[model samples]
Target chain A: MTMLPPPTSKKLGLVIDLDICVGCHACAVACKEWNDGGQFGPLPDANPYGAEPLGVWFNRVHTYEIEPKEKGAPAMTVHFPRSCLHCETPDCVTVCPTGASYKRAEDGIVLVDEDKCIGCKLCSWACPYGAREYSEQRGTMQKCTLCVDRIYNESFEEIDRQPACVMACPTRARHFGDLGDADSAVSKLVAERGGYDLMPEMGYKPVNKYLPPRPRRDGCAAEPTPAQEEKVDFSTSPLLRWIDKVLSR
Target chain B: MRPAFSVIFFTVMSGCGYGLLFLFGLALAFNPAVSGRIEGLVQLGVGAIFVVAGLLASTLHLGQPQRAWRAFSQWRSSWLSREGVASVASFMPMVLIAGCLWRGADATTLRALGALLAAFAAITVICTAGIYTSLKAIPAWHNRFVLPGYLLMALLGGAAWSWLIGEWTGGARAQPALIVALAIASCVLKHFYWRHIDAATPASTIETATGLGRFGRVRSVEAPHTEENYLTHEMGFQLARKHGKRLRNIALLLLGPCTIVLALLAITFQAPLHWPAACCAFAAAILVTAGLFVERWLFFAQAKHVVMLYYGGARMHDA
Candidate 1:
């Protein structure tokens, strides 16, 4: 039963823009908050007040400092938000032995059936992205559901009906829509921004795409200043003159 | 890649068990007159105990041991499921062979049943090896060498156990020699396996990981979480080079040359009722078990998972 469903025409996924992201952990926190009490609620935190604490979370944000490759190149910070990409050829699903892990035929959202999962943790090993989280307390594996319960909810306004991470992004850097549709807003964003796949060489064919930060402008370039030999330039400023007088004494 | 005690015990103990059963079945088929019925029963009983104890040890790692039966359902795609099914199925032929021995069946009939039992035993070991070999995510495990290493170790361990039985019952002179040859082969194969892994490179890098190759060198300034999480705890084990090297030396010295020498000594100078041979065989088993334990620990400790790229380590590149 862990056999993957046939490729769905509707690959609903998220498109994350790196340029506007401010490295705020709102997405990760929002994901935890919503999922904690939502479909996969109560992401337990073991030894919450102890010296060493651990918990299960569906999303995480990592920050990287891209150092200058050249002598005077300007550096940049990239805040990467990671979750399950809902891959087309997810090894997590295929490696599962109890039919506990599976992908949906309609939405392409990969999910783990807590009831059937034996907590063998093989699926966790198969995932290269480290997206699968095992709950030691519940004895089941949990992962990013892409907010399935809220995305299709008819009671909520269409504008509010999206992944908690996307809705909570202050900069609107995270966009959610049908990625399979060429004309969808998310697909258009991907096309215009040259969105790329993370670990494409891994061959998982991740449904989610990430838009790389735009090229830094000339103003941000680190141009080396010429060394000047001139001295005694502070003669006109009284504060500098007083400091110079004190230093001369 | 954290080496859980349960898994270590399972692989080592079960491997010896399967190996012993394989040799016992082969002995019954080719040389029924080599030993008496009592010795055969003892061999089968020991094999069964090791295999069962190993299987039980494996279940200890599972979060829900009550639902362990569900693992047997996905043999078509999962090597683990196949192993579960194969191990259970193997019990049938083993029990039948034991019944034949108990009834003092004719040599020809026992030989046929023995061959069937041996085939089942070999298949079960292959399935066990396949469980680790088939994992593509862990490059350290996914390889041709893993299967051969496993097969050879099982054969060697089984031969050693059979030698002990033969020595006790005054069975055959060729048996200890066969065990010595297998021990030598297994040690050589294990060394090669270690060398191959030591020289291997990373399968993926941070540049490829984030699709930021065009940008300047990518390096982590901050992790996603401050405290350790399940992923880090499970896959982020790091080993010092000095400790790893020392452990490897111990394993090689004890399991390889020491065991081989002990086994050879037992065979070279035979005594009445083979008492000296039996003592040497017992010593060899203890040495190999202790040596392989260290070797198996190093196997997990030294492996660097691709997930470690997110943590701090050497950069990975696209395959």
Candidate 2:
């Protein structure tokens, strides 16, 4: 039962644009808020007001400073949001001793069936992306469901269905759709922006992709002339010269 | 990577148990005269105690210990599940062999059951090693050294313990030279493993992790959170170089020279089935087990998981 299913062509995933992310953590906050009470409710936080607070979150954002490759080019900061990539050949699912962790063949979403999980934590170790979250209170392994409940819920408005992180991104940095479709908006965006997979050499064949930061124009090799230091010609306008003389007196 | 006490205890205890079980089975099948009925029963009882204790200790590591039985369902794909199944399956032959010893069964039946038990015991140990070797996320464990290391160490510990038991019961002694050879081989394998990890570079780096290598050098300026999260808590354990070196030295001394010398001393006094040989074997057994404990601890503590790349551990080996 832990064996992986054949590859799915309907791979639904996210395409995150690093060029526009402001690192405000709104997406992460929205994910916690929704998943905390939505289907995967009560993401427990230990010591809420104490010195050390620990909890399970489906998404997290990291910021990194990149030194420009060219000497004169300015350094840039990239806000990186990380979550489950929903890998095609995730070892996390196959490594499960219990048939708890699995990847759906329909949408290529990796999920943990909490009811069957024995909390062995082997799946957590198998994940190179650190996506699996262990809940101390529930005694089960939890992870990013990609908002499976909301995405397929017919009760919600058609426009309201999507991952909480993607929906809440103010800069619209996150895009979600069926990446398997070549003509889909998300796929086109990926192709146009050169979207690439993170740690491709890991060979997980991640469904999610990231668009790199665009080049900036601030580092162009050009000097500006100082216009502020130019002297005014009083002889050109006699009226302007008379007004200036009166003001000086 | 965190080196949980429960897991370390489980592996070490179980390794000794299975090792002893294999040797016992081998002796019973090849030469029944080496052990009397009472001595055979005693050996089986000891091995069973250690095996049961180890299995119980492993359950403590699970968050839901009551659901451990579910783990046996996925043996088709998971090495951990296979290990669970193999270990439980092995107990059947163990019980049958015990019945044969107690009931004075025919030599042919006893030999068949003993051979089955030995095969089962060895397979269980292999499954145990497979659990770590299958994990490609940790480079230190996903290597050729880990498999042989586990096998050799288990045999050495078992041989030493069997020597002690044989001396105490006035039965046939296990070869002292075998113990010495096993000890030296384990030492050499451990050295190779340590050297391999020390010189190895991580396959995944922060640049690859973020897919930003074209931008130039990437450094984490801000962490996702101020408080430590589950990933960091479980995988970010860092052993200080000074302490790691000291512990490695201690493990090497106890397992290598100390064990070899004690084994040699046991050989010198083998003619007299008295306190001298027994004491040497007993001391060797105790030191070997203690040394293995330290070695196992280092094994987990030193492993660097690839997920550390996201948390400012730019390179896996550097972490």
Candidate 3:
């Protein structure tokens, strides 16, 4: 049975603007908030105050620093927020020992039905991205639902019916729309900005797009700029004075 | 993967079941037995229970259960296929040998047939292990240690199960010897396998796994997919090095020493204690078996498969 609309109905997905993302983690928190309170119910924490704190989370933002290839350039920090790509292939669904996990062929969104899950943890083993997390108490697999509840809810305006993470993005780094439709906003953004996916060769065919970090201007840190030089306190700064003395001596 | 009851039962039952009858066939060949004329028919009857039941349990793992029969056709290439065929074929001589033993006659031809059946049964156990050990794609399984280790596992499992049977049979003579050999063999192989894996380096590094040239620092930059891919699902396995190390130590401590103790007990004690000692031997076997399952899981998890190369993991050498 088709629980979701087909690929033609502007199959919406996440388009993350890696350049604009400030590593704020607002999207992740908002996801937890909406998903926790919404139709999926609580995402469940094993021990919120325990020694080994582990539970389910759909979105996790990782921070990484990229050093310039050329000498004398400052490193740039980039934030990567990961979630289910709702891949075209969706290996998690195909490999499920029980049919609890499946993909909506129409829009290419992967989901766990939760009813048939025997708490096998097999799906978690199959996921390379570590996307699927085991719910200890409930004995089921939990993952990014692509905010299924909000996207189709008619209670709100048409445009606002997007995922919580995209809606909550403070820097406007996150965009939600269909890539299956060529003219969709997400597709256009992807075309204009060259969005990439995580570990493409693994071939899950993730629908979520990650816009690569925009190249920063070179020589940002080499031979301090005149503005930086003027800002530097020459005489009173012990570090500078000591260096100068050492050179003179 | 959780250790399913069916598999645990099958591995233990089949291994020792085959081991016992195989030994019976061997003893018959060597003329080493002092008493109890080789009851080929009865041995065949008992062997059928182990072989059939174990095979049935193995089928429970298959998604398409009916296709299991088709597994036998691949004997030319697949070890799994070879295992199926070997297991099935071992039954033929077994039945023939049983017929001979039941005639209340000592036929020279029947002894040769019985030995062949026992030999096939033992080979089937090895082939069952070869199914896992042959997968070169999985570095943990691809290792040289896997072949011997799995054979040793089958032997140990067989010995333990046979001990239980021996205990039930009012303390049989050869059970102790079988237990000692299997225990020592299994424990030693496990320790060696653990040490080998522990000392090994990742076949490839994150940079090389991605096929990115050496020297340039490579980070995820951004992951290519969101939901789990097959490579990550299959190869991104992690035994969490520390936990793997800890479990390995536990296996060594429990299985190794207990194997020795059980052997000594079997040598020293004669009756009720022998039965309990057999039970204890199996208890150690159970622990080792469970540990091996964890070890197998870690084997897959920590393997960092060649496919994980694209996911920014390194490739490893077989050695």
Task: Please report the candidate that would top TM-score against the real structure.
Answer: 2
How well does each candidate superpose onto the true structure, as a TM-score?
0.91, 0.94, 0.59
Top-scoring candidate (DockQ): 2
The superposed Cα distance between candidate 3 and the true structure at residue A227, in angstroms, equals 3.6
- What is the overall TM-score of model 1 with all chains considered together? 0.91
Q: Enumerate the candidates' DockQ scores in order.
A: 0.56, 0.76, 0.04
Q: How many residue pairs clash in model 2?
A: 0
Rank by TM-score (best first): 2, 1, 3
For residues A182-205, write the lDDT of model 2, one tens digit per residue. 999999999999999988887889
Give the better candidate number (2 or 3) by DockQ.
2
Worst 10 residues of 3 chain A by lDDT: A1-10
Interface RMSD, model 1, angstroms: 1.2
lDDT digits (tens) for residues A35-148 of candidate 1: 999877778889989998888999989888887677576888889888999998888887777888889999899998778888888888877788988888888888999999
Residue-level lDDT of model 1, residues B201-317, one tens digit each, is 655777777777688788888899989999989877665344877888898887778877887787677765557777888887778777767877877766656676766425532
Quote the positional error of residue A1 for candidate 3 in Å: 10
Task: Report residue B20 deviation for candidate 1 (angstroms).
Answer: 1.0
Q: Number of backbone collisions per candidate, in order?
A: 5, 0, 22
- The alpha-carbon lDDT assigned to residue A236 of candidate 3 equals 84
Model 2 chain B is weakest, by summed lDDT over 10 consecutive residues, at B310-319
Positional deviation of residue A90's Cα in model 1 after best superposition, in angstroms: 1.6
